[model samples]
Target: MSIVSSEKNRCIVLVGMPGSGKTTVGRDLAKRLGLRFVDTDHEIEARTGVKIPIIFEIEGEDGFRKRETQTLDDLTRESNMVLATGGGAVIRPENRALLRERAVVVFLSVPPPILWERTRHDRSRPLLQVSDPRGRLEELLKVRGPYYREVAHIIVEGGRGTPHAMVKLIEKELQALCEH
Candidate 1:
């Protein structure tokens, strides 16, 4: 559980590339912290009544991004929750500001190789549906790393560790952040 120093309850927002274990870690961390867990992608799907791929197929990435921004704005206002954002959520500067100002953002740092290894067989990721996906992952990492860092209050390395272990580490970091 968290020991938030301030009176306001800030949400814990997890930002990272696909397969960086945001959803998994967010769920565990939320459970440990006695908070709700919300994944922006899943919540989008729930609200739209369509899968993200279908949204991407019909309306394209731009439309999906609009939805993502709306969802990010909405979710960031909710207190005492863990939010897992999509890989490209930070593409928009407004979303980055919302996350940074409204919540305590955690960037899950995983290398491109590990990201490829984790997501190679995942067909659901619209961005990685291209030739030379490993290269694409590296390109994305290069492009988005700065944006992630811009909003992150804590950066957790997710290259190694079980979800449970990662949750413990995040919990410790959250506690330490509270102390500071």
Candidate 2:
């Protein structure tokens, strides 16, 4: 059975750790598909009138998560969009439920080593600010990998390519799925 035509109304939800290229790929994917693009982190920041780092600083992870969950709920209510969720968004069961219910989740899989290299200098990620961020990322990946896989209808290995290339790859896969 092919999922191609049935995927027309579906939203594409990108899930991955920080620096996994979710935002970049989502923007490209949306453009390629002529759909709207939304990043949950940006949406949270916009709605709250504060940055994600500030949210983490003020409300902590739990508080930021509440906002993330709400944003995910609102974004999923629409169709034909590419949504890039924050890395921790899948940690909550409700967020997962909303993602599974409203979108075709895709895991932009990145190895822990690559993630460390990409995010090492980035101070914006609250969780990655720890001393042993790589170790923490490894542990987190081990725990969250299953959740990501569970929610994802597809998995795309995010290699060392430009966002446009990644978009093309994703579009190929999506078009293939749609054709059947």
Candidate 3:
């Protein structure tokens, strides 16, 4: 599969679960491709001057999601960059539509067990802050997996490894896609 360099030059959006290393991999992918990288979560925090967890606390998930949708809409419309979206971004049909229209949506697939081991100690993720974070992850996966699959142009298996390695693998796959 060979992908045209022109097509590969379009925005590359990374979608995955909380601990799937989207942000980290997006940065490396962007660097390797000479494209700008934007993490929607970081953009939200920067634009609002508040962390995501704090936003969720003050405005609730509904408010946070609205902001997320707006931000994604704006970003996808304005730039040809690598975007790392939130774990739940694909849950909304509108978001999925926008992503599919504007970018090469890639799902960084990681097993639930790997996700649990990776995120067990992370306290910054609002969705994973529950008393039973592992259970919550499972529930989320069940609901979101199909949506992720539906939107993904490519799916990369991301195990417990450095973001650079994952990025390398994705780049290879993407290049192959272009060649075909």
Q: Rate the local accuracy (lDDT) of all candidates.
A: 0.90, 0.85, 0.88
Best first by lDDT, ranked? 1, 3, 2
> lDDT by residue for model 2 over 1-180, one digit each (tens)?
322225433688999988899998999888877788999999998899998888899999999999899899888888778999999899999998999888888899998888889888988888888889899899889888999998987888885777787778787777766665
Give the Cα-based TM-score of candidate 3 against the true structure. Answer: 0.92
Candidate 3 C-alpha RMSD relative to the actual structure: 2.2
Model 3 Cα lDDT, one tens digit per residue, 46-68: 99999999999999999999999
TM-score for each of the candidates: 0.96, 0.92, 0.92
Best by TM-score: 1
Give per-residue CA lDDT, model 1, range 36-93, as digits (tens).
9999999999999999999999999999999999999898887888999999999999
**Residue 73 local lDDT, model 3:** 92
| TM-score of model number 2 | 0.92
Worst 10 residues of 3 by lDDT: 1-10
Evaluation by lDDT, superior candidate among 2 and 3: 3
Which candidate order results from sorting by TM-score in descending order?
1, 3, 2
Cα error of candidate 1 at position 15, Å: 0.5
Model 3 bad stretches (over 4 Å): 1-9
| lDDT score for candidate 2 against the true structure | 0.85
Candidate 1, residue 31: Cα displacement in angstroms equals 0.6
